[model samples]
Target: MTALIMLVFSLASLFMFPLMAQPLSLGLAIMISTLLMCSLASMMLSSWYGYILFLIYVGGLLVMFAYVAALSPNTLFGSGSPLLFFSALLVPLSLILYLYPLKDFSLMTVLSDYSGFMYLKSYGSELISPDSMSILIGLGTILLLNLIVVVKICYYQHASLRPFNEV
Candidate 1:
């Protein structure tokens, strides 16, 4: 259920990009909403420690999003800004940190291995091309990560909650 919601929001974010007259604002909103929803669901379903870490992660995302949104194209730090680039870095970083507690190296390795291939197609494209392949890759990565997390949570929950009769 949570995975579905995350997937929906991620797809929405991708579609929203092309329609954004103010890309920064729209991107910020979509990012914040995505982070907020993920964190909220994690808090409700995971341990307290997980909730705390999720909150911190979401906070950092919000700060970075705001920073990117504040810079003007003419400002010293503005044109061809690295803020979005940095935010992209955060996606995989947060996934690694969040899943580290699970100690599921197989899942992490799979995600990491595919991460480069997932975005590599964009490197060959011309800068002026209106195709938002990078955005699609970013969204896909987030959805994949969310699915892994949800599966991990469900597996553990089922194991821990099993009744003595079932055991």
Candidate 2:
């Protein structure tokens, strides 16, 4: 029940990220979402795994925040409608999940057969296995591509990436 609630809240906050008025608010949303994900992972896998994952996520977020804070300006304030919408959505989703007979589902049965808890334990193990080296390399490649993209976007003189200058 707690995990479901966490998932819902995280997802709702994720949806609200773009609606945030300030860059700080967006960063807060991102941090909250990431923390919620970490918590969920901790429940499914292990505390150690979640803690390591969270540390990595927070480290990346801090670096990204530094870049964005130096680059992005505070734009116009956003409206409150999305908050209300998320609130409405959260209640019903929670209720449905809470009342639903989740045990009866075949998916849960299969997951239970694999070291319990939705196969997350085995999945985490597989991630550390030799067969998963490609996954790690793929993640590195993605990071490299992201750096290349950011560099490509940086050379242009944009009002967003650079602070204002007075004549």
Candidate 3:
């Protein structure tokens, strides 16, 4: 199934994280993995959700790329070990997947049915329904806590992330 292939590619890309030596390479790897994940999400859920998720990830990655480009020195890319390793790992994974088959792994079956289509349509609304108010409140509280923590950290006069003032 497409989802299985995406999952395998995502895992393979993630495995390269530890092998990355440069900030740029790491960022590139992260972007690739995020893309695969978003594609998988699109297949399993709604396309709109995956599109939004990918946009958010791209925004974050842009910020990260800017920071790394500014703070890190330009370094030549390392040898092709990562690619070789990735290819090596992918072959075995593909072999295993081919050898051991899975049943009903594709979301196309669910999407093909009218009830399933309706369920998917209502899935978004269910999240914010009255019954899930507690979950929303909890998420809000967590975000508030995170904001407070970030503000506290950034408020320090000598914080590295603080904006520079023109002398």
Candidate 4:
């Protein structure tokens, strides 16, 4: 039940992304939503997975925040009527949730009951196992490709992201 509520809140926070006008506020909202999602993942999956997810998200967020802060103009953030907007969104969300019941699909309860199972003994070990090698390779390949693409994009001679003073 708690996990379900957390999921709802996470979704709500994600929905609020478009409402944020300032980059700083948007980054804050993204961080909050990522935290909520990581907690939800921890409850549903393993704590290790949640921790990794949070670290990855936060690392990417840090880079994005640095770039946004450097490029965007510093503007005073005006207070908006968030209470009214939140209430408006909350009422509809609550109505939908009430109309459609959600079942607690968290795996923690099931795992706790059969704690001695051999197959489920170690969660992280499967990543390095031979059976999952191809998946790992594929993920690495994708990441490498993404890195190359980003480097290529940023290396354009006339691009805004070029070296300082044409170094």
Candidate 5:
């Protein structure tokens, strides 16, 4: 029940983010906050696997934030340059990394994933670039996976506690 509520709230916030009239910075802040809250909640409610996934998501957000902060807005989308190409390539790569986390998805994977997206859209344009969209979709997939793990854990825990319930 708690997991369901949290999932609903996070999904609602994620969708509602774009409809507000706030500045881009404010939107970023909201995204960070929402991500943090969801990550923490998942960590608390989930098993080891779910916790690891949440950590990866949190790490990705931080990295993306840093990359966006470090780059000059002009260079991000100025022209056909190496940085743009690298950033573009990084998006899919990060997604791949996130999906197949090495040694358990930690902060590093999260940071790399997010950073790649930010680098792709460092310019002062819209935030919803192709990379960003991919990231979002990836996140949604992770969330679903985490939820499944949580459900499985809950089922096993309950089963162990009430072995005779089936009878």
Candidate 6:
């Protein structure tokens, strides 16, 4: 359980690394972060949930990413120094974090004992429960809403998003 928490934090740091990047790179980072988070969730919770989330993120988000990539100005991003600095900073933080848990194994054991506990399980079986179904449906609805919002925001009339029609 401690390991899973550590893994999630590590993946979270991976997500933060992309904030220094351009939009395309940031989108890629977000996708990678989603994948890593999904994998971690799969390990901690259920494989199907993780798999479904990953698929939804990739399939639904890629179109929006492409639209932004096409519409956004191609600025020359040269933020290499910050990336290096973040790497140096994150490595020690992760190591220190990992060491902290090793010093307290009793807490880890207690957390592990409760790994199977979830509010949804209080309702019914995990696989076929209304909680799980609602979660999946909610995720899909959110993705659809996001897609619509992105499409709306990227109007062709907007100067930033408009394509050049001149020959």
Candidate 5's residue-wise lDDT over 81-102, tens digit each? 4234444544555555546643
Error in Å for residue 78 of model 4:
3.3
lDDT of each: 0.43, 0.60, 0.62, 0.59, 0.42, 0.54
Clash count (model 5, backbone only): 5
Count clashing pairs, candidate 1: 0
Q: Which stretches of candidate 2 lie over 4 Å from their true place?
A: 99-158, 162-167
lDDT of 3 by residue, 1-167 (tens): 67778767776776666676566777777778778877765655568877897898789768766655555445679999999888888987777866774443333444446474466366586334443343334334433433343343234563445568899
- Best-to-worst lDDT order: 3, 2, 4, 6, 1, 5
Clashing pairs in 3: none
lDDT of 2 by residue, 1-167 (tens): 67778866866765565455455666676678778867765654467877897899789878877786666555665677767877877887677767773432334335546664545455566445443343244334434543443453334575375656789
RMSD of 3: 8.4
Model 2 Cα shift for residue 41 (angstroms): 0.3
Specify the highest-TM-score model's number: 3
TM-score of structure candidate 5 = 0.32
TM-score against native, each model: 0.31, 0.62, 0.64, 0.62, 0.32, 0.55
Model 6 scores what on Cα lDDT?
0.54
**All-Cα superposition RMSD per candidate:** 21.6, 7.1, 8.4, 7.8, 22.8, 7.4
Which number leads on lDDT? 3
Query: What lDDT does candidate 6 reach at residue 122?
Result: 54
- Candidate 2's C-alpha lDDT? 0.60
After superposition, which runs of candidate 6 have C-alpha atoms over 4 Å from their true positions?
1-18, 99-159, 162-167
Prediction 6 TM-score vs. true: 0.55
Q: What would the TM-score be for candidate 4 when compared with the true structure?
A: 0.62
Worst 10 residues of 3 by lDDT: 145-154
Candidate 1 per-residue lDDT, tens place, 1-167, comes to 34434534444444334333342544454565456444533432234533564566567556644544443221222343333544564566446545543222233235335665445334533212233333334435555543443343334334334446553
Clashing pairs in model 6, backbone N/Cα/C closer than 3 A: none
